[model samples]
Target: MRLSLNQWTTRRWSVAEAVDGCVRHGLEAIGLWRQNVAEQGLAESVKLVRDAGLRVSSLCRGGFLTTSGKAFAEALDDNRRAIDEAAELEAACLVMVVGGLPGVQPGEPLTAGASRDLAGARERVAEALAELAPYAGERGVKLALEPLHPIYCPDRAVLSTLGQALDLALAHPEEQVGVVVDTFHVWWDPRVFDDIARAGRRIASYQVCDYLHPLPEDVLLGRGMMGDGVIDFKPITRAVLDAGYTGDVEVEIFNADIWAADPDEVVATMKARYEDVVLSRP
Candidate 1:
């Protein structure tokens, strides 16, 4: 298994620290985030990764096309900049977390009585994809649409299933638009195996993390380390490899606990967990 550590897995580490950690642990790949890359300076980030000989498995984000009017245009502009960053890093794909319900005001509760049209938000995402996919392709970057778990439907992302992501990706060329098979999001999908198989060559990236037990108040930070939660990785891992996805698998945990721990230990734990739970099936 080609294991890549997502920078978010050790959320506190800087991009330079993450690169050094990967090198220290003998990992050949690291997934990057745009914020840290920017803080480190794009040219420096490129050089750092090149010097460390670390391949960027995937770039953190590049979507959020659910707004309207000026916000919509701004969102598109941001995505273009994201594509440019991914190109500089030579990332495998830019993970796209298309925004959620349109009208929820900042700091406002997503559950407020207003009925949000999820379908409409998804339509907006499709429209944005049509506009951005060609641009990404021209830049030699692929947009990997990532579906968040349905629990985040109203607030974070409208794309809530691998099948739904695949549905949207069908309109574009496979090399330009693809679906991400993130275990934390797609593990509960009844058709995960089928959809992964269907995704086939269109599977741009495969992210692994556990869905924590006893949901935390901040569900967004509830991603657990593998084996510390209920996700059964064997089937999912096998299905992904069977589907012909020959890309680095990223461990993208968001747990506050893991982030607070020493990053080197986190990387070590990730390696052990991958060997134990993720790879040792049967």
Candidate 2:
């Protein structure tokens, strides 16, 4: 398995710097976030990775399908742009964090005004897949649906389990959409292994990060590097491998401490922890 550094792990680095750091560390792949790409200009970001011979395992995001009317239309247009950007970078997939209630934003607290009907929010996600899948396929890019933890259901992804993500993705052709098996989010579920097995070829990305105890004040920043928290990487990773996922196993941490460290050192820590933790299985 190849080790991929999801750009968010080195949150402070610019696109050029991240690409160079990947090469310097001999990492074969990197995951790009749209904000970073926009910061560097898509063409320049594409060239940087291409010149460095790095494979973009996946693009950070391309979904937020909870709005309606004008906002929903705008969201669709923005997602199309995200797909186009991913295509330009030759990314394997555009990771989709299908958004929460109609007006809630990611990582923010929900207000009384936000809709509380979870079922309706999920329906919007299904509608989004029907709308975006064909477009993503036309560009040879797959929509990699990611299930954020249940804590994020009010503000981030309404889809909150690997199984839920898989069911949502099954509506589209495997080439048009697939699921991301992020250990950080799914590790706590009892059916995780079964879902991982079921994912099989539909597993577009396998992001590795641990769930920390006493989750950070901002629950969004609670992901720890592989060996730093309670997760047992060996079993979860074995399940992913057994599912026939032959793709980059990305280290996608979100801890403030990690993001604050030197970028190169972060890469080095990722490599070591990856070997000692993730690869320790099978």
Candidate 3:
């Protein structure tokens, strides 16, 4: 399988700087974020990746199920724009972080003892995905649903597990919709192995990162380099390969500590760890 790195690992850097780091580490692919692309103009960013001989594996994110009416419409429009940007960059897929609770933004005040309407949020996600799928399909870009951990259920994403994400994708059954397997999100799941097998070829992309403690903001803190973490990545990697996934293994660490260091050093360290631990495993 080819190896890729996500710009999020070094979100502290500029888009150009991130691309340069990926190339410097000999990574074959890289995932770009919407914010990063916007900062450097799509044409220029695309050109930079091409010039460095790197493939755009996927775009970082798009999807918010919280708002309604004008808010929902605006979200859809932004996703379409993201799709267009992904097409311009020739990315393999547009990763979707399906949103959480309705009418509640992250860090917003919550009603006392108010339970989140998870089912409603999921239905909204499905509807939004259905609407966006055809558009993404028309652009020849796949939509990858990245199931955030349950820790993010209220604020970040409602799709909390691989099984749930696969269920959503199966419901759609369209070529445009698929699932992304991120180790950090799914490692603690009891059914992760089973879902990985189930995902099989429907796996749109794979992300590698480690978590030592509880969910924190996107940073590398508790995340030990691949093997340094508690996860059994070898079996997971083998399962993915056996299930017919030959896509790039994209390393995505959201650690503040790592970001504070030089971007190039972080890339190099991740590449070396991936090669020594995950890749070298039998």
Candidate 4:
């Protein structure tokens, strides 16, 4: 099993340090965040990870194509640069977090105006993908669409289900587009198991993070370490493996507490939990 440690899980670690940390844990794969990569300079960061004998499982993100006018144009330009960076790193995919309705705040009632059109936002995502898919394909990178949970529907992501992500991917060639199956986001879905089966080779990335209840005020930080929350990893991991997804299983947690811990300790705990839960399947 190829296990990957996403940079966000150890948010305090520098790019060079994070690569060494993965090596210390006997891990060969990592998921990198854009901010960390930018801090180190893209070329330098790529060389750092490569020299450490680490593989980038996937790039954290490159999408937010739900706005309009100059803002939407800028988002596309950023995504293009992101694709270039991914290609340079030889990352498995450029994960895309297609944005939700613009100006809509999380857990709050929607405000009227141009941003209130959910359908329009989704249409914009499709259009953005159409423009980006060819660019990614030409550079030998895949665009991985990640669907956030329903609770994040108001602002974080417009895509909210595996099936929906798959539908979007279907519009483009399989090599150019794919879907991400993050346990924390999809575990609560009634159709997740079925969707996983359907995703097949289109499954580009599989991120592992458990979900905790009594969510934090900033719901983004509510991600729990694997096995710490209610997710039953065996079944989900089994389904993913059965789907012919022969890629790294990345542990990506957004919890503030985890971020506060020592990076080395965080990686150690991640390895232990992955072994006991994700890799313990029949």
Q: Which candidate is the best by TM-score?
A: 2
Model 2 regions more than 4 Å off:
none
lDDT of 3 by residue, 1-282 (tens): 888888888878787987877767777899899898999998999999899989999997888755578878899999999899989999989999988787666656676744477888888888898798889989988889999878678877889999998998886654788999988888889999999999988899998988765545543255655765678777778888888888888888867777788778788888787877676355
Give candidate 1's TM-score: 0.96
RMSD of each candidate relative to the true structure: 1.6, 1.1, 2.2, 1.5
Candidate 4 or 2, higher lDDT: 4
For candidate 2, write residues 79-135 as lDDT tens digits: 999999999999989999999887776766667678888898888888878898999
Which TM-score value belongs to model 4?
A: 0.96
lDDT of 4 by residue, 192-271 (tens): 99999999999999999999987888898999998888899888999999999999999999998999888888898888
| Candidate 3 wrongly placed segments (more than 4 Å) | 107-115, 214-224
- C-alpha TM-score for every candidate: 0.96, 0.98, 0.93, 0.96
| Per-candidate local distance difference test | 0.91, 0.91, 0.83, 0.91
For candidate 1, lDDT tens digit of each residue in 8-113?
9998988999999999999999999999998999999999999999999999898878887898999999999999999999999999999878876433675554
In model 4, where do residues sit more than 4 Å from their true spots? Answer: 105-114
Candidate 1 colliding pairs: none
Indicate the residue-level lDDT of 264 in model 1.
91
RMSD of 1: 1.6
Task: lDDT for model 1, please.
Answer: 0.91
